[model samples]
Target: MTARTARQRLRDDAGSAVVEFPLVAVLIILIALTLIQCALVVHTRNTLTDAAVQAAHTASLEGNEPEDGATRGAQLVHDRFGEDYAVEVDADEKGEGVVRVRITATFPLIGLIGPSGTLHVDGHAIDEETW
Candidate 1:
C-alpha cells in the first residue's frame, strides 16, 4: 500500500487522452451535424412558407389568375433557395375574393437529399378590388 506519486500518475494518464480525444471529438461532431440538419429542415420549411405567401399575394391581385400565382410561387422558391426545394406549387381560388397557395417541397436531410413532400406550407390572401 503506497502512493503512486505525481510522475507515475501523469505517465498512466498520458495515452488516455489520445484514446478519449477521438471518441469525444466524434460525438461532438455528430451532435453538430445533427443540429445543422435540423436547422436546414427548418429553414427550408420557413422559406417555403414565404414563397407561398408571396404567391398568394401575387395571385390575389385584382385581375391576376390562379395559374399566375402558382407560377410566381414556384419561381420564388427556385430563385430564393434553389430548384431542389420547389417540388410543387399550387394556387387556387378559395372563394370569390380569397386566394390560397400551397407549396410542397423536399428539405435537405444531408446535401440536398430528403423525403419528398415532407415540407408543406400554405398561404392565403384576399384579392384586391376589381370593381
Candidate 2:
C-alpha cells in the first residue's frame, strides 16, 4: 500500500481506541456497581446482627421492661433495615444469664437462584451488667 494510504489506515484504527474506551468504561462501571451492591448487603447483614445482639443483651436480663427491651431490639433491627427484617431474642429460662439473638432478612441479590432466600445472622451478647 502507498505510504499515504497506510497513514490513513492508522488514523482510522486510532479512532477505534476511542470507541473501545467507552465500552470498557461501561463494563467497569457495571462491575463497580455490582461490587457496591454486594458490599451494601454485607454491611446490612452485619448491622442487623449487631443490633440483634445488642437488643438480646438488653432484653435477656430480668428487668421491669423485659418485653419492652425485646421490642426495642426488634425495633432497632427494623429501623436499620426496614420491614423485611426479623429479630428473635431468646432469654434463658434456667437463669443461666445467656441471651441469643437471631436476625434474618431476605437476600434479594442471591435469592434469584439460591434456595436460601433469607439472609440470616446470629449474634450473642451478655447482659450481666444491665440493671
Candidate 3:
C-alpha cells in the first residue's frame, strides 16, 4: 500500500474509538447500575434474615414470652436497617420446643420502588428448657 493510503487508514481507525465510546459507555453504565441493584437486594435479604435469627434466639430462651421475639426482631430491623424496613414481625410456636420468627418488609430495588408484600424472611430455633 502507498504511504498516503496507510496514513489515511490510521486516521480513520483512530477516530473510531471516539465514536464508539458513547455507545459503549451507556451499556457499561447500565450494567454497573444493574449490579448495584442486585447487591442491594441481597444485602436487604441478609439483613432481614439476621434480624429474624436474633429475634428467634431471644424468644427461644426459657423465660421470654413469644411476643417478645417479634418485638425484639422489629427493633433490630429498625436499628440496623431503618424504620421503613421494619414493616411486620411475627413469632410463632411451632411445636413443643420450637419457635419461629418471620419478618416481612419492602424489598428495595430502585430507591423505594420495589414490590410490596413479597419479601419474607424466617428464623427458627429450639426453645430452652429450665429447671
Best by TM-score: 3
Q: Please give the clash total of every predicted structure, in order.
A: 0, 0, 0
Model 2 quality (TM-score): 0.65
| Model 2 Cα lDDT, one tens digit per residue, 72-100 | 66788788757655445433322454555
Residue range 25-131, candidate 1, lDDT tens digits: 99999999899888877888888898899999999888789899999999998898866444788888865778899998876668456454467799899888543
lDDT per residue as tens, model 3, 1-131:
69999898877766778889999999999999899888988888899999999999999998997798999999998998777653799998876778899998887757557554358999988888632
| TM-score-better candidate, 2 vs 3 | 3
Candidates' C-alpha lDDT: 0.83, 0.63, 0.85
What's each prediction's TM-score? 0.80, 0.65, 0.81
Q: Looking at candidate 2, what is the lDDT of residue 53?
A: 71
Q: Show pairs that collide, candidate 2.
A: none
Write down the lDDT that model 1 would get.
Answer: 0.83
